[model samples]
Target: MKMKKFLAVISAALLVISTLSACSMSGSVEVETEFKVEEVTEKEGTTTVAGKTFVVKTNDGSGLNLRSGAGTEYDVITTIADGHTVQIINQQGSWANVTYGTYTGWVNMDYLNETTTVAPIVETTAPSGATSSPENPDTQSGGYLYSYAGFNPAEITINDSSWNLTLLNRHYTLPEGYVPQLSEAVRGSGVYLDYRVAPHYQEMYDAALQDGITLTPNSGYRSYQTQKTNFENKINYYVSQGYDRVTATQNASRVVLLPGTSEHNAGFAMDIGWVTEDFENSPAFAWLMENAQDYGFILRYPESEDKQAITEIIYEPWHWRYVGVDAAKEIKASGQVLEEYLGVR
Candidate 1:
């Protein structure tokens, strides 16, 4: 399944590169060197050419992509908005290395306008000496905007698109009807993860197995109703212990999420090992803590007061969550919870 997805994505990207490379770059050079372009389609916002400056000219709502390499197959650095000026670094076939703010990546030359000078971005200060408001986050100092899709707290909600890197925590809850894809996590565990997360989980499990570690997926996605019942049952037990119903509910919530709030419903969080503190002493837990980030998984709750302060959850060494590989690497290196890394906390 992963191979098919990989092939499909790669094949489509290769097609785009093939088409682009076939296009001619024969426009008259305004500078000493000739950069490829069959014709200058738009001349209005062009700043500089001949490998010095090029303006993005997608000419539509869809912006041009700046990629890691000179091909569509490379990862996108960011999207270059139409008419936005850029500083060039180098040029390869059908692509040019360009600088967009702090980002440096390759962009398709077909969607560029050649120019003679790099235009300055004029920062507009607030009129009447009024301070900037939330209505325009860009007006704040050190707030130059880029097209990178950063973390969004709104995606943590029940109606969120599951494909997003949603931060599931106490504040975010899954919808009652939110049943994401489920696939068997292992051969015999009968456990399953969200289809979006299953492959990465499998990859991590396999790697851990190779290292003689028994990293198990004890639990995965749970239905909202199931979590609600579990919370209620825990609440009932606490109430039977001579606590008031409200107090019991609150105590119950400390351990179990009140239904939709459980990260299990998100299908990315999983309980591994034996679900005990002793698991932290196991070689499996040690291996996972060190290597899971390679597979896009992170120990969701570590035994750290600082992390617990931000996550508002007790340390659970057995709990792991799947963010993306990039985010996971950053989180592991920084030792921050999902909330802090995402700027949500």
Candidate 2:
């Protein structure tokens, strides 16, 4: 009986050891299975969360314009070269918010082709003459800085005879011999303007007269030749003041636009009261600032430094452009310069 009990106890001990070993093996398998599943899940999440990459594809090779806003009507932040890679951040209609090098802005998705290959991160510095600040950073709507380097006006010439909304600036100019139909801006004032602008100017002049202000049209409707003479005279005046030819020309551009670049050449802009800064102090300017938008006129060059940077022109309180009543009101309400409103700068 003692021998049988010993054998039975040995058998029970073996059974207990086997059961514990099985449980330990099962736990080990479960832990290994869970780690494999977690590793796979993490790898999948990383791929899924990463932004898709794209390459710029342009047929003209002029590069794609990265804009401050989603549409072409928005200000262009920079130009991305063809075949450059960008990572899309978001999409709106046909536009995609993208990051190229150190720059971030919106680009047309139609010009981008999806790429599975990831681009290596590259840091870049802003172009010389670009304005940047810590608060504004360097490459976005709130921070992107525009420089006047390497700009060729001939590349952006506009030949269209759009009386109201045609853009003329250092970056954009009228074609040679471009002219508009003209009439007197104010009866007997001898200042001519585009026929579309004359009626509005007459109404604005009449309204100002009702308010006891004489809103005289001092200058308007300059032909290309007239604009050229005016620009040369300005350059000569600056040269007489001891400036080099290059510097004088630059300085002259701030006051008198270069030939076809002047709004006066387009026959839709008018200079009222005086063309100097003293015009800002006059009641005529104040009245125009308050009521000109109602008659489809807007102060062309504003006094803001940002606006000056965009326009590349000095503040001119007396200069006004006719953009139709709706556009005038919108531009005034937005407090943006014509370049920003029209998105051509």
TM-score of each: 0.53, 0.55
Q: What TM-score does candidate 1 reach?
A: 0.53
* Candidate 2, position 153, lDDT: 66
Query: Which digits, one per residue and each the tens of the lDDT, describe model 1 over residues 151-191?
Result: 12222454345353676765665556788878877767677
lDDT of all predictions, in order shown?
A: 0.65, 0.71
Number of clashes in every candidate structure?
A: 7, 0
Clash list (residue pairs), candidate 1: 25-37, 26-37, 47-115, 47-116, 48-115, 48-116, 49-115
TM-score, prediction 2: 0.55
Expressed as tens digits, the lDDT of each residue in 148-174 for candidate 2 is 212246424434464478788876777
Pairs with steric clashes in candidate 2? none
Q: Which ten-residue region of model 1 has the weakest summed lDDT?
A: 143-152
Q: Name the runs in model 2 displaced over 4 angstroms.
A: 1-151, 155-162
Candidate that scores best on lDDT: 2
